[model samples]
Target chain A: MKEFLVISGKGGTGKTSITAGFAALAGDIVLADCDVDAANLHMLLEPVTYHTEEFIGSRKATIDPTHCSNCRLCQESCRFNAITSTEIACTVNPLSCEGCGVCSFVCPKGAITMHDHVSGHWFLSDTRYGPLVHARLGIAEENSGKLVAKVREQAQRIAQEKDVEYILVDGPPGTGCPVISSISGVDLALIVTEPTIAGLHDLERVRQLAGHFDVPVMVCINKYDLDEAYTRKIELYCQKQQIELAGRIPFDRNVVSALVRGIPAVAYAAPSTSENSAAKAIGDVWQAVRNRLLA
Target chain B: MLITIASGKGGTGKTTVAVNLALTLKELLPVVLLDCDVEEPNVHLFLQPVVNESEKVMTTVPKIDGNKCDGCGKCSEFCAFNAIAIVKGKPITFPELCHSCRGCTLVCPTGAITETPRQIGLVEKGTWSVIKTAKGTLKIGSPLAPMVVDAVRNTAPLHHGDQAVIIDASPGTSCAVVAAAKDTDFCLLVTEPTPFGLNDLTLAVELAKKLGLPHGVVINRAGLGDHSVYDYCHEADIPILMEIPFDTKYAACYARGGRLVEEFPDLSDRFLKLWDVIQHHAKRHQREEPKT
Candidate 1:
């Protein structure tokens, strides 16, 4: 089985919309939303969750007040400054803690202990298209990369159990840890970019990240008509890099309407002819992607 | 006051709101715009500032001395990130995966481990007219974005009595956003009107609440989607700070790396109004907090 990840280096470049459209077109596929920090594919897929699990991705240091004697050693030893000392006692800030266990080790009184924090929840669900695996990380939570990895692992397991041929992953934005976790080991990464300077700049960053992981990459310019020149520039960059240009989707209000309606563009009823529709372009992109995956 | 513009969802106009607000407020106050979206800094693209100073942001990682090494594997055992490995009784360090926590050096039985500076990113300070601008650019393939973000925030000039700092945070409520939002007086969350927007906005609101930071929402692309985001805000008692209508003109200007206020001069008043609302909300929230 092959996994195809749809990602954009910058946010709001239509990664989820394009991934949702591909899910609508691709058959025998399991869907995974690895953007655990902001999992939006569930809004489009409307999955009915069959299984749920708490994601204890990391540990948070906690101070036991009962053990008393505030030496403030943990606070001084913590590199993340997660421990705060006041007149009464020292406390741990969960948001700032990296769960590195340095504070607990350095505590003379053995008051600080690492406790497993339930940072998020992962779900296995059934959608209109196929089985789906997704997650929701708690607000201000770290370990999103770990949660994403868990979501993808479950998605791949379900795909294997169901004998599915592909796993379509909706990855998070940026070239950060979560994006790295989502794209790593995937068969192909489909980078959805726009025709803007920010788009081009971020595309290069994510492309470089993909190269670091030795993963093959494909490019698609969403809202290509926004700036013809930038789109041409992106085309040239992709050509020079020997990356496949899977599709160029024109800016379409229908894509927004489809999102507002909480459905994939390919599944939405287009008010006008499909000739110039962004959904049609997405379909062609999916076809190209499927051909490449199969080949 | 330090105000951070953030969104849990990407492409929600965080940078657009931040840049426009900074440009508009520079007329009334000393404004410093810190682009803390280190992984994908874009405010510079729109502002086009003339960078006057650039500094490298470095993080320390453990460098094991091979000659002094009697690798008991203690360093590898103590490393939380698994950045150290003992092969053939020799400690190998993977600086890329290191979190710079100094745990390995402390845990090493021998005096073999030493801390060394590794460049993670760069922070540049510049000016666009009267508005001071600073941004952090993470090195390609580096995963330590929060470190860079903190460096950018640290580079901001000391806040005077009348100075206002506007931080443009990266999308998502991760460590990077936390680093950017830390110590900010208020956060302005930019979102849209769709379900996805509402879902992520809720997460961002929770983040603000957890951080104990006063925050308001600015709904971008207001007409393109449902009223869910507004409904969520109203139900949650979070103030709706502003609403930027979905206009092709604004989109076109943004596509061309142009500022919203510059392209449409009429939007200046709106951004200024946004500043007023933010100040009022921040003041009221601070007053409501009981004295310790």
Candidate 2:
């Protein structure tokens, strides 16, 4: 099955909205919300989870008070400054620790030990489109990249088992570890960006990142009418980079109202209107993306 | 006071709030605006700071010496990031995957592994009008965002005890956000009124609570969705510091790379009021904390 990833280097550029639209258009597909830290795709798809598992992405160092010596060695050797010493005892701050195990290794009294931390939870769910694999990392948790990789792996496994046609991944924002994990090894990376200076700047960054990983990238300008000049600039940039322009979607209040109603724009069955302009644009974009993927 | 502007979800106006607040406060105080959203920083676009100096941000990765190596494979075993592998009885290092934890260098029994500096990004310093500005930009493929964030924070100009330092943090509640929000006096979490906004705002609120930082909320695009975000904040006892109405003019100004305070001078007073509220909260938090 071909895996298509929807990513935006900058946040709040409608990546999840476009991904949800693709899920509605693609028939036989498994959806994966790889934005583990802030997974919003499940909100639109409304998945019913069948299986759930705790994800222990890393370990945290904890102080065992039973063998307390208050030597302060662990506090000194820790690069993260996670260990704190007081008049009473020494303790480890889990938020500051990166689980490098340096404090545990340097503890002369053997008071520090590394324990597995359940940083997040992943689920295998059934959505209206197909099987969905998604996860939620705990608040203030690290290791989001690891959690994203796990979600992608589970989605691919379900796609192979069910003989699905595609795996549409809604990626996290930014060019950080989580975004890298989501876009790496994907068949095509479709970037959803707005027509703005920040959007253009971030598009270049994410496009360069995709090129580094040797993945083909396509661009979709969301809210293109907000600035016609900037939209033209984006078009020129895509042409210069030899990247395909999937489609341009105008800003629409119907899209926001559709999200408020907890559904994709394409799936919005308004009584008065059959299809919104944004949904129609997304339909065309999906057709072009499908043709490219098949080729 | 070091005030960090953050949001759990992307595109929620963290940069807008931060840039406006810094510009407004700079009229009354020396302000330093540090953009810690290293991976995809947008503050520079609005501020239009003319960069005066830039420094490369580097991280230390393991450099294995083949001649001194006995091929124990211990370095690979200790690497948590899977950056090292024992191939053909020799250790091969992948610098991009390395977290720069120095675990392999400490655990190498053969003493063949050494640390070397690898450039990950750049931290730039400049000024936009009266406000001193700094931003971090990660090299396109690098995954070590927190390292660049730290570099940006470290390179910021030193502020006096009374000056304001506003940081625009990256989206999401991960290590990058932690690096930006650490040791800040207050955090202004910007969000919209949508369900996605509320869901992510909840996580961001939890992060602020975990870090023991005093925080308030600034709702952007106020009329776009329901009142669930305000209700969640009310139930959670999180103060709604300010609200900016959803306006197409604001979107157009942002699209044109114009500052909010510049386009709408009235916003200056609102941002100044935001500073007062943040100070009030910070003072209240200080009074509640016990002296060591």
Judging by DockQ against the true structure, name the best candidate. Answer: 2
Best-fitting candidate, scored by lDDT: 2
Range of the 10 consecutive residues with the lowest summed lDDT in candidate 2 chain B: B155-164
Residues B1-292, model 1: lDDT tens digits: 8899999999989999999988888888899999999889999889889999999999999988888889799889888787999988887888988999998888877788999999989999999999999999998778889989988988776754478889999999888898999777899999988877888888898889888889999999878878778778889999998889998778878887988897789999989889989999888888997335
lDDT of 2 by residue, B152-213 (tens): 88975565558898899999998899999988889899999998999899999989988889
CA lDDT of each candidate?
A: 0.89, 0.90
> For residues A45-87, could you state the per-residue lDDT of candidate 2 as single tens digits?
8899999999998899989877868989888877777888878
CA deviation > 4 Å runs, candidate 1: A66-68, B87-90, B290-292
iRMS, candidate 2, in Å: value is 1.2
For candidate 1, the share of real interface contacts preserved is 0.73
* Total clashes in model 2, counting residue pairs 3 or more apart in sequence or in different chains: 1
Task: For model 1, state the Cα shift of residue A64 in Å.
Answer: 2.7
Docking class of 2: medium
Candidate 2 segments exceeding 4 Å error: A65-71, A87-89, A271-276, B156-160, B290-292
Specify the highest-TM-score model's number: 2
